[model samples]
Target: MSLSIKQQLIAQLDRILSAKLEALAASITSTQESRDSDTKSSAGDKFETSREMAQIELNNLENQAEKTARMLNELKQIKTTSTATIGYGSIVNTNHGTYFLSIPYGKLQLDGTTYYVISMASPIGQ
Candidate 1:
């Protein structure tokens, strides 16, 4: 069966979100490895610095992952079949506005025109 535009958008968003989650998981794993090495080497100040840096990186990744997850969840929450209205997974067009109904991944070309990729929850999308 052919998928609707909304379904296509959701699939795209899911792909992006899965990659993001994998990256975050990898970061956490690396951080844990570094912490373990620091403990084994007893590097003192250097160890502490590395640990702090890893912690900071992990925190940043967590924040970004959370935001992406929320976007994905919001997309899943939307339930509409009309392409006439702009909602999650619904590409929208206006006289001066063009937006994709998924995560903002920058600019995309559709029908030979550049449309700004935007998350459905973004102000531009709203």
Candidate 2:
């Protein structure tokens, strides 16, 4: 069956988030590997610095992946069939542009359509 605009948007968002999560996971894996491979060299503090940096990178990537996964879950819970009123899962169209009132994410392009996906709690959404 054909999907509605909302469903399509959610699908696009999901794809983006999933890809982001995958990239983050790969980065974390690489960072951890580098950290594990790091050894104390004649540079004294260089090994420690590299290990610390690798841990920081791994932490940041894991955090970002968690956030992306959370957003994906949120998209999955959204009901596509809704009203014109501005609220969560609502598509608000203005004289200037179109908006998908859900997440705080800014602009997204899909099939030649440009949609500003903003949070309902944002000032623009309000």
Candidate 3:
């Protein structure tokens, strides 16, 4: 069956988030491998610096993965059906643009129409 605009938007978000999570996982894995393979050379300071850098990168990637996972969970909770009041998962149409109150991902274009996917916490969403 054909999906509504909201459903389509949710699907798109899922795809985006899933891809981001995968990429982050790959990055984390690569960083861990690099750090593990790092050998202590004559220059101990250089080796320590490399390990520290890798750890920092891994930490950042892990944090991003956690955030993306939370966003995916949020998207899964969204109901695509129309709502009487504007809130999360509501699709708003205005003269300026169409907005989907789902995540912070911005500027979605579908079927020749533009949609601004915004989080309620954002200034514009407020």
Candidate 4:
């Protein structure tokens, strides 16, 4: 593949990460608002339950946001220039399939060819 292919892949991953982070932030904000508004009504048990659920959801969303941010950082660190060896930012084309050693984004299609974007820490990547 050419440098442009890697650049395009990086751009796609960046967009995906940004959109995910944005959605997670929105969800976290909404959950926080809902939890804050859950005042102690006449039914204290119900209020507590609602608040707890919101808190759990907020925690999950926050975790996802952090992970997405990390992915964005990793993507930013990728160099589009070709490498002589199979390593980070390397694009490997085999008889079985093509692989992009970056983040674990599963499968991505570019110019009719499907590429697997995988992290170095992943089983296949290792």
Which is the leading candidate under TM-score?
A: 4
Candidate 1, residues 1-126, lDDT tens digits: the string is 113644655665677777887887788778767766666246678767877887788788778878777766776776545655546656666787766666666675444656576865677776
State TM-scores per candidate: 0.70, 0.89, 0.93, 0.95
Mark the regions of model 4 whose C-alpha exceeds 4 Å error after superposition.
none
lDDT of 3 at 112: 91
Query: What count of clashes does model 4 give?
Result: 0
Prediction 4 global C-alpha lDDT: 0.89
lDDT of 2 at 65: 82
Best candidate, lDDT: 4
RMSD value for candidate 1: 3.7
The model with the greater lDDT, 1 or 4, is: 4
The residue ranges of model 1 lying beyond 4 angstroms of the native Cα positions read 1-3, 40-43, 83-89, 95-97, 101-105, 108-115, 119-123
Look at candidate 4 and give me any clashing residue pairs.
Answer: none
Scored by CA lDDT, what does every candidate get?
0.67, 0.82, 0.88, 0.89
Q: Which stretches of candidate 2 lie over 4 Å from their true place?
A: 1-3
For candidate 3, write residues 5-113 as lDDT tens digits: 7888898889989999999999999999999999999999999999999999899999999999999999999987766788988888888888888888889888898
When 2 and 3 are scored with TM-score, the better candidate is 3
In candidate 3, which residue ranges exceed 4 Å CA deviation?
A: 1-3
Candidate 4 structure quality by residue, lDDT tens digits, 60-123: 8999999899989999999887767789999988787899999988899888989999999998
